[model samples]
Target: MGQTSKKRGVGLEHWLVPQWPAPNTVFAYVTTRIGGVSKAPYDSFNLGLHVDDDADAVQHNRAQLSQCLPIDASPQWLTQVHGNCVIDALDDGVVREGDAAYIDKPGLAAAVMTADCLPVFFASKSGARVAVAHAGWRGLLDGVLENTLKRFPDAPQEICVWLGPAIGQCHFEVGGEVRDAFLQASTSKQGVAQAFRPSDTEGKFFADLYQLATLRLKAYGVCSIHGGGYCTYCDEERFYSFRRESRTGRFASVIGLLS
Candidate 1:
């Protein structure tokens, strides 16, 4: 896995720049809960409008984010429903309804907002394609990653992925039924079993979302996986966790090909 770096310039210091070996034309970033205008629980960089933050504040934060990108880049934002829907990103100024956005055209970035849910970044080795997905457990179980890959012009092996921050296993506890659902969804029963460890309570387990996502990617023959080991719940200063705080805001994971 490659180490993710933080932007150093003024007003962009807290943003995360993925350090994977993506082609120079590919640019990917993840926003932290820093450098924005929202207040209190959503304080700072709250990117999700659906989270009940003041609409004006979110737009201000979004505009601030936009200034950090290339001059011609237009980010495609979506109303995420946590399903497997993936759409081709467009700059038509409409907020589309989907969980993932794919872009092959230059200057159009694919973006997804998440608080605790895993945000996955995908790009082709050639850097001609890029995508971002908002993968909560429901979306993962529903094949959101698979659906995103289907939009790529390249094969699974030709794609590289980065697993962004989420509620790590230390804080991501799930019921037996959740574990059973994943087990039922995969043929690699033993592999799937490894992603869950029995929590202190009976009939409960601590799930490893990163591991589960990696398993899913590997099952599809994608080998160049990177960027894991971040804990949104633990890093309160830098991330927002829905499980940690019921009323909170979302950060964004965005990727695009430079024009």
Candidate 2:
């Protein structure tokens, strides 16, 4: 199983895929800074093409990832501007500006980049559809998850979601504006910031992105949410963290139907 180790939140191994009730035909996985050709900083296995890592090295890393895919295809990468735009995974020739990609057809993989931003994976109940979202605070506030969900025919509860590794509340310090944005995103403006607490520094808060996202999904009646609690900032060997180290590489969370 090129998925994950039984000891979930430990060192970086091969892959860090979600293990839940998604249909057997649905394929979803995340990459770590291991098992590839990248050198120091990126270390190894860095798949993002936009980062400053060597293009040849990234190609090599991605080629390694392509070998692990159940299908003989590469993931459809996006320019992810931390916006709400969602596109079809099939639309991947030139890198488009989008935060998410939905793929209904088998063999096409949808992926999003992240060093600290959350990577959200989606799969329809019957495995007819799969998608991946890049959810930085800006994207989440602007409804990237909402946009991605709308691309599928199923309702919120009919889809299964997995929240991948990201900067946790413990280390994710944010300004008041970030909190206000989430409050504005929520219709009720109630308890949306409950996960956010006043930081030791004035006018700052420790925002819980996972809580904020789960709250939004629950509002839309999404129930089968899994994964989270692994902090990228804390897991030095297992993940790359932009907040912790600026010149780091991005990993990916990908999803698609296995052909």
Candidate 3:
């Protein structure tokens, strides 16, 4: 597995560049909701059009992000149904109805917008392809990560992944249904059995999304994983958390192959 750099807060209008072993031909970044033109609550960098924010404000924010990408890439945003569907991002401007997308072509980017849900960036160690995933509990339970890995027929051991910001274990309280879903989602080798511990609340557990992701990835043979230390619910100044603020904005996590 590649060693991950400690995530740092990138200032306004900029991006949190994932510090990984990806080649120069591959560049990936996650936008912070710190710079843009939206107003309060959705103040500044809110990138999602589905959030009931002003459409103009969302479009303006997207434009602001597109300008900073490699080769001025336009992100292929998804409708993101929280399902397991993974698509090949072959064209731009069309929103796919899935939680994950991968691309082999250069100068085009695949991205997912999130507040507290985990944004997973994928890359081949050789820089031949890249992908991204939005892994909330539903997607995780229903096999979103596995579906994304299916897009790459190569040995999963050669794939490098970085998990972006999300609600961490400390605050991700879930009911028995969620725990049972995870337990029955995959085999024990995937570590689903250990991802939850009984919370103080009766019949509830504090779930570990990062740990769950690691188990799923390793189970699929992806050995090089990084960047799971961020807690979206805890970092109010840098990340937007839906759990913390239901009416808040969303940030974007993007990955693309470069020419």
- Name model 3 segments beyond 4 Å from true: 1-13
- Residue 174, model 3: Cα distance from true site in angstroms: 0.6
Go through the candidates in order and give each one's C-alpha lDDT: 0.89, 0.83, 0.84
Candidate 3 residue pairs in backbone clash: none
Model 3 weakest 10-residue run by lDDT:
1-10
| Error of model 3, residue 142, in angstroms | 0.9
The model with the greatest TM-score is: 1
lDDT of 1: 0.89
Clash count (model 1, backbone only): 0
What is the per-residue lDDT of model 1 for residues 157-235, given as tens digits with 9 covering 90 to 100?
A: 8999999999999999999999999999999999999999999899999999999999999998899999999999999
> What does the lDDT come to for candidate 3?
0.84
Ranking by lDDT: 1, 3, 2
Candidate 3 on 1-259: residue-level lDDT in tens? Answer: 1232222322324678888877777878888878788887988789989988999999988876766665545778899888989988854588888899888887668889899899999988878888999999999888899999989866898889999999988889999889898787677734776889889889999899999988889888899999988889998878889999999999999888664
Go through the candidates in order and give the clash count of each. Answer: 0, 0, 0
Q: Identify the runs in model 1 with alpha carbons over 4 angstroms from their true place.
A: 1-10
Candidate that would win on lDDT = 1
